[model samples]
Target chain A: MKTRYTYGGDEHIYVEIDDEMSLDAFFIALSLSNMVREANIPGVTEILPANASFEVRFDPDVIAPDAMMEKIKAFEHQAEAQEKRLDTRIIEIPVYYEDPWTHETLMRFRERHQDPTGSDLDYAARINGYETVADFIEAHHSQPWFVSMVGFVSGLPFLYQLVERDKQLEVPKYLRPRTDTPKLTVGYGGCFSCIYSVRGAGGYQMFGITPMPIYDPEQKISYLKDFMAFFKPGDIVKWKPIDRAEYDRITQAVEDGTYTPRIAEVAFDLDAFNDDMTGFNAKLMEALNDA
Target chain B: MTLEIIKPGLATTIQDLGRPGYFHLGIPEGGAMDRLAFRAANLLVGNDEGAAGLEAVFMGPEIKFGAEMSVAVTGAEMPMFLDGEPRETWTSFTVKPGQVLSFGFLKTGARIYIAISGGIDTPPALGSRSTYPIGALGGFEGRAIAAGDVIPVGDGSVVAEGRVVPDALRRRPGSPAELRVLTGLYWHRLTEKSQKAFFEDDWVVAPEADRMGYRFRGGQPMEFVDRPQPFGAGSDPSNIVDGCYSYGSIQVPGGLEPIVLHRDAVSGGGYFTLGAVISADMDLIGQLQPNTPVKFKRVEMDEALAARAERKTMISEIRQSLS
Candidate 1:
C-alpha cells in the first residue's frame, strides 16, 4: 500500500495520491469530510492538476493546514483497504475549430512547432481525433460540458481538459494588445482552453465567438445566469460538439431566458446584507454624474 | 438630526467599514478609501465604527443642520466654518439648530471624513453601507451626495462628549508621499529594470484618477508577460480567483503604467497587477491629488502584517477611550 502526502500552504494546500486512479476518490473523500467550512473556499480556488500532482486551497482560518493533510492521509488509508471504482462522469463539449481565426491560429502554432514530417498536424489531429473540424462539430450534438471557474469579468468560467493531448501546445505572446474581448468568445492558449466574458483586451489566441449572454444581473435566482457553473475540481469533462445550427439554438435559449445549463446544488442567497446602509442610492447617482 | 445639502462637494458618498465576503459573486469590497480616518471621525462623535459617514472629495458641501447635534471632521486639512465662524477640525463640536456648517476647498488630501453623533440611515445592500458607483448600489439612494439631498441620521439624539482627538490625526499630512506596497501576484513577471523603475520612479497621479482607480504618469511603461494569458481567474493564479479585487490592486494592461484600483472599481478584469497597496496606505492614496508626486516602497509580508496588527491595536484603544 502506498501512502498519500498532502501539504498545506498560506493560500492553498497540495494533495498527492499514490496513483492517477486515486485522484477523484481523494477529492470526493476530502470534500465529504467535515474538516473545513466549504464557504471559505477562495474565489476560483480549487484542486487542480499540477503536472502529476494536484493542488487545492481554502481559507487557512477555516481549515487548519495540519488537519487537512491528515484527512487526505486517512482517505488514502481507507481507499487502500477497500478499493472501489472511481465515480467519474464523462461530459462532451462540441468544439467547432473551423473559423478563419482558428485556422490561422493552427497554422501559426504549426509554424511555431516547425515539425519536419507534418507530425505537428498529425498530433493535433490525434488530440482532436475526428476526421475534420466539421466532423468534430457534428459528432457531439447533445453532449454536455463541465464548468470550471466563474466570476471572471462577470460570471465567466474557465473550463477544460477537453483532449489532454500528450503534445504540449505552445502559445506565443500577443503580437499587439487591444482593449476588449466580449462575453462568450472562445480563445485558445496552446492546448489550454479559455472563454472570455465581456469585452476586454487580451493576449491569448482567440478562435471563435459566442453571442450567448452567460451572465445576467436581472435574474435574482441565478448568479451566473445563462451559464451554469457546477463543476468543481476532479470532475470529468467529455466534450461533444454541435453543428452551427444547434449552437444557435443554445445561444437563443440563453437570449430568450429559457436555457438552464447543468449545475450543482449550491446555496445562493441574494439578500445577504451583512452591514448597515444609510444613503447609498443618492451617493451612487452622484458618483455617476461626476464620472 | 438631518443635514440638507446646500452645495455638493466634487464627490461625496456615505461609506461604512465595508462589505466583506461575497467576492465569489463578483462584488468588490467597496468602502471608505481612508478607513482609519473614517472610523476615527465616527468614534469622535459618539458613533459606531461601522456608522455611515460622508466621504467628501476635493471640497465639502454647505450643509444646514435641522437640529442641534454633535459632529466630527477628519481626513486631510480642509477649511470649515460654523455659521461664519472658523471651525477647527479633529474636535467634536456642537452644532446649533438651523446653523449652516460649510466646508472650504481642501488644502491637502483629496477626501475628508464627516461623522454625526448618530449613524446615517441608508438601506443596506449586500451587507454594506458603502457605495459601489458602478453598480449603483449602497450609500444615499445608491448615489453620490448632490445639491438638495437630505441625509438622515439615526435617533436624532445627542450623546455625551466623546474622547479628545488623537494627535496624529490633528495635523493633516501633505500630498506627494511615498506609498508602501507588497509584491503582487504577478510581480515576478515584470522585468528587473521595470521593477526597479516601478519602485524608484516618482509617479504623478493623473487628473483622470477617480474612485474606480488612480491613473499615474512618469513610471516606466509595464511590459506584458511574454506568454499568452487569459482574463481574470486565468490571470490571478492565486487564491483570489475570479471577481473584482481589493482596492489598491495596481493593474497594468499590456504593460501600461499601473492604475491603482480604488473603491467603486469594477468587479473583474484581465489586467496584470504588479502589486497591491496595503489597507494601511489606501487612505493616503485617497488623499493624493492630481499631479501629486508619489513613490512606491516595497515591504515584505511580515512587515505589512505587523503594521496591520499594530493598527488594529491602536484603533481598539482609541475606541476604548471614547466609550
Candidate 2:
C-alpha cells in the first residue's frame, strides 16, 4: 500500500496510510507508530495514531525535518516487514443501554438530531434494518471491535467492528452538534462507535452509558494508575450489555476504587483475521474467555 | 512570596511554554497563546523563556503584592496602574510590598501576559506549568484564578529594571491581518472555486473563539469535490476518515465555518483540514481579538522554514539584548 506524507507546517509531519478506514490501514498505522515510539528519536515530540493515518510532531532545531522524515520512512519499512502479530489486551466494557442520563440529554438536543421524534437507539436500529433496539444491541455486542484510534478527547476510543464492510453498522452524525453530552455516554456515528470520555460538545448519536471511566486524571483506578487514559490504539474492546442493578453496582465499585476492568492479554494476527474472520474471532474470544 | 488576586479579570490563568510530547495520550499542548509576548515578559523579568506567568484575557487582573517583586507586562496594550497611579508596559518595573497592580480597558490585542522576577510557583503537571482546563490538569490547581486566591511566586533572581523590548520587535495586532499558511493534507479535497474563495475572502473571527479554536465567517461556504463518503466518515461534505490534526490546522466543518485549531484543540477528528497556519504566524493568531478581520496567504515550504528561522533568530537577539 502507498502512503502519503505531508508537512504540517515546519513542526509536524502527517502520514496518511490510506484514504479510507480499514483494519489493514489501521494495522499499518499502529505498527508504524509503535516502531517510531520504540526508536526513541530525540526530536520526535509526539506520535498520534488515527483511524488510517498518523502524525509526528518534531522539533526541527533538534533534528532537521528531512532527517526525521528519512528516519520515519525507515521505521515504516521495518514495521511493514515485521510479524503480523500485535501484543495487546482485550477489555470488556459494561454499558447500560438507553440509560436515563443519555436519554434525557439526547432528547433535549432533538432539534440537532436527524430523527428528533425517536431516541438515538431507535433511529440507529431502524436505519440499520433492525426491527427492534434489542436486536440492534445484540448485533453490536455479538462481535468484538478494534480500537482503531484513541483521540477526539483523552481516553476516547474510536472502535470499528471486526465484521466485513457489509455487516458494519453505519449511521450519520447529528445534523448539528449538541452543546453537552454526558460523560461515558456510548455514542455511534458514521461507521464507528465511541464512548465519550468527558462531558462536552459532541455530534455522535448517544445510545447508552458506560459504567466504568475510561479517563481518570487522578489515576484512582488501579488499571489506569500508570496512565490517565485506559485505551490505546489497537486494543480490542467487547461491549457487554448490563441491567440497571449491575450498572449501579459497577458504578459504586468504581467510586470505591475497587473496579478492575476485564482485560486479557492477546496476540492479534491481522493476516489470520483478514483471511478467515469467523475462525480468527472464535480463537480471539476463546483467549479472552479462557483467561 | 505570594500575590493576592484583588480582582480576577476575565479568565486569568497560569501558563508557560506548555506540555508537549503527550499528544498521543490526547492531551493538548496548553500554553500561553502568544509565544512571542510570553517570552518577552519572561526575558524582561530575567526568567527562563519557559517560566510560568499569568495570562489575562480582555481585562487584566488586579493583583496585590504580598512581597517586593519585579514584574513586566507584555502583549495587549492595556492601561497599567500601580496603586491608582499610572504605570508603563513592555518594560520591567518594581512593585513594593502591599502595592496593588491593576489595568484599565484593553486598547489592542486579546491577551496580556504578566511575568514576575520569580515565576508563578505552581507545581508542574505533566512537565509544564501550562494549564489544560478541560482536563483540569496543570497550573494553579488546574483551573483559572479567581478573586481572593493567593498564588505563590518563585525565588527568581532579577536583572536590572526598565528593560524594554524594542518597538520594532513588538507585534502590532491590526485589522485584516494577513496570516501565512502552507496548504496541504486534505487541501486537494476542496473544489477549485472553494479553494480560490478561501484565499481571496477576508474572514472575520467569531466572538465564540477560545483557546481550542478560532471560528471564522464571511468566506463563501467551502465546497468539496463530490465523492462517496468513506466508511466511518460522516455525512458532511467536509468530512473525511478520521485523521490527526496539527495544532494550527484549519478545518471547515459542514463547509460553513472555518476553524483554526489551537494549542488546546483535540488531537484528531474526522474533519477535512485544508492547511495549517505556519509556525511563525501562530503568535499573530494568538493576538487576534474577536471580530478581527483576517486573510490567509499561501506560501511554499522554503518560505515557511525561513520564517521559522527568522523567529528563532529574533528570539535569540532579544535575549542577548536583554542580558
Candidate 3:
C-alpha cells in the first residue's frame, strides 16, 4: 500500500494508509501507530488511529515537520516488512437487543431516522436483506469485530466486522441527528457499529444498549484505573446478545463496582486471518469461549 | 482569595492553556480560545502564562471580589467598571473587597479574558483547568459560570500593578481577516473551481460558531471529483472514511459551509478536511465575532513555522516587558 502523508498545518501529520477501508488497511494503520507510539519521538504528542488512516500531533519546535515526516515514512516501511502479529484482547460486550431504553429513545426520535415508521433495527434489517430483526442480530454477532478506531467521543469504538466487505452490514445515518441518545446505546452507521460512551447528540441508527459502560471519567472501575477510556484502536469486541434479566444483572454488577469485562488475551495473525477466515475465526472464538 | 459571580454573562468559564495528549480518547483540548490574549492577561497580573483565567464571550461577567487583589481584563474591548467607576482594559489594577466588576458593552472581538493576581484554582481534569462542557469535564463544576457561584483562587500571586500591554502587541479584530492555512489531507478531492472559490470568496463567520468549530458562509458550494464512495465512507461526496482531524483543520460537511475545527473540536471524525489554520493565526480566529468576514490564504509549511516562531518571540517579549 502506498502511504500518502499530508501536513495538517505544522503541528500534525496525517497519513492515509489506503483510499478504501479494509481490515488490512486498518491493521497497517494500527501497527504503524503502535510503532510510532513505541518510538516515543520527542515532539509527538498524540497518536490517533482511524478507519483507514492515522494522525500524529507534534510540536514543530521540538521536531521539524520534515523530520517527523521522514520518521513516519521509515516506520511505515518497517511496519509493512514485519510479520503482522498483534497482541490484543477480545472483549465480550453484553448487549440487550430491542431493549426498552434505546427502543423508547429511538421511537421518540423517529422523525430523525431514515425510516420513521419502523424501528431502527427493522429498517436496518430490511435494507440488509435479513428476514427479521433477530436474524440481523444473529448475523451481527456471528463474527467478532475489530475496533478500527476509538473516537467521536471518549471510549466510543468504531467496530468493523471481521468478515469480508460483502458480509459487512451497512446503514445510512439519520436524516437529522437525535438530541438524546442514551449512554451505551449500540448504533450502526455506514459500515461501522459503535456504542455511545456518553449520552449526547448522535446520528447513527440505534439498535440496542450495552449495560456495561465503556467510559468512566472517575476511573471507578478497576480496569479503568489508569485510563478512563476502555477501548483501544486495535481491540477486538464480540457482542453477546443477552436477555433483559442478564442486562439488569450486569447493570447491577456495574453499579455495585463488581463488574469486570470478560477479556481474553489472543494473538491475532493478520496474514492467517486473511487467508482462511473461517478457520481463523473458529480458533479465535474458541480462545474467547474458553476465557 | 475568591470572587463571586454577581451576573454570569454569556458563557463564562475558566480556561488555561488546555489539556493535550488525550486526543486518542476523543477528549478535546479545551482552553482559552484567544490564547495570546489569555497569556497577556496573566502576564499583566504577574501570573504564569498558563494560569487559569475566566473567559467571557460576547458579554462580560459581573464579578464581586471577596478580597483585595490585582486583576487585568484583556482580549475584547469591553468597557469594564470597578464598583461603577470606569476602568481601562489591557492594564492591571487593584480591586478592594466588595467592589463589583462589570462591563458596559462589547466594542470589539468576541471573547474577553479576566486574569486575577491568583489564577482560578479549579481542580484540573486531564491536567488542565480548561472546560470541555459538552463532556462536562474540567472547569468549575464542569460547566459555564452561573450567578452566586464562588470561584476559588490560587495563591500564585505576585505584587504587580499598572502593567500595560503595548498597543502593537494587542490584536485589533476586524472584518475580512486573512487567516493563513496549510492546504492538504483531502485538498485534492475538491474541483479546481471550488478550490479557487475557497480562497477567493470572503466567508463570514456564522452565528453557530463556537469553541468546537467556526462555521463560515458566503463561499461557493464546493464540488468534489466524481468517484465511487469508498466502503465505510458515507454516501456524501464530501465524506471520507472517518479519519483523524487536526485541531484548526477545516472541513466542509456537505461541500457547502466550511467548519474550522478549534480547541474543543472532536479529535477525529468522518468529515473531509481540506486545510488547517496555521498555529499563529489561531488567535485571530479566536477573536472573530459573528458576521466577521474571513479569507483563508494558503501558505507553505516554512511560512507556517516562521509565523509560529514569530508568535513565540512576541509572547516572550510581552513576558519580558511585564516582568
Best by lDDT: 3
lDDT by residue for model 2 over A105-172, one digit each (tens)?
99899987878899999999999999999999998888899988888777788999989888989887
Between candidates 2 and 3, the one scoring higher on lDDT is: 3
Candidate 1, A141-188: lDDT as tens digits? 222222333333334444433222232232322333333444455653
Q: B71-145 in candidate 1: lDDT tens per residue?
A: 888887789999988887777888888898898777877788988877787878768888765445688876788
lDDT per residue (tens digit) for residues B116-231 in model 3? 98799989998999988877788998899999999999885556567899988887555678889999999989999998889999899988788888889998898998998888
Candidate No. with top DockQ? 2
Stretches of candidate 2 exceeding 4 Å from the true structure:
A37-42, A62-71, A74-78, A286-291
Indicate the docking level reached by candidate 3.
Answer: medium
Q: Alpha-carbon error at A191 in model 1, in Å?
A: 9.4
Q: CA lDDT of A205 in candidate 2?
A: 88
**C-alpha lDDT of residue A32 in model 2:** 91
Any runs in candidate 3 off by more than 4 Å, and if so which?
A: A98-123, A172-181, A201-203, A242-249, A287-291
Roughly what TM-score does model 3 have, to 2 decimal places? 0.92
The full ranking of all candidates by DockQ, starting with the best, is 2, 3, 1
